[model samples]
Target: MDQGTSKGVSRTDSVDNGEGTVSKALQGSRKKKRDKVSAYERAKKVYEEIQEEKRKERRLRKQEREQRQIATEKYEKTKRKANKMFRKRSKKGQPNLGAQVEILLEKIQQKMK
Candidate 1:
């Protein structure tokens, strides 16, 4: 075996062709490039997964908002109908059985709360 040194670099084993030479330093740069591409691919996959999870959460929130709106509309329609029925009987100046029942039921519900 032969050893040589040149300008702060050391070579352990090397072969020289008629035109050029091969060295470990040149191969190390190619390995570094391969590592960079792999790291980029892994990061891209993680970002996509995060976006998908956010989309699912948004969909769930939208459904909850729609359900709440539907429930509010139903309660308001029922209350409005009950009020209209009571007003009609009061305008006619007669106490009707149906209006009395509705008033009693509303009072009972308020007391329970």
Candidate 2:
């Protein structure tokens, strides 16, 4: 019974002539090699993940900027409304005591000078 190349292994490695010597070559070569398509797929997957993270960060920053603009607008609107109310009250015979005190104090200081 003559043994030829057995499943890609050389014939010399498979046949033993009563001796116990075995070759260690080609022992790790039986595993399938990594193809180019699989490596490309992995790199593409990693790139897409990084792009998604960047998009999420941009979305969060955009939301924060919009919230800050809305808060500033609300503050400006409240200030305008308060000033309008104060002017209306003063026109309706309601004098601000703090303004009268400041005017009297300035008059007294000018007289002393």
lDDT of 2 by residue, 1-113 (tens): 44664556576565343565355453333223433357779899999999999999999999999999999999898667555544553656886666556556755887999
* Model 2 TM-score relative to the real fold: 0.45
lDDT of 1 by residue, 7-105 (tens): 544555543444566565665675688777577788999999999999999999999999999999999997887777766645578766787687789
Candidate 1 versus truth, CA RMSD in Å, comes to: 7.7
Model 2: runs farther than 4 Å from truth? Answer: 1-32, 35-39, 89-113
Q: Look at candidate 1 and tell me the lDDT of residue 33.
A: 81
Per model, state how many residue pairs clash.
0, 0
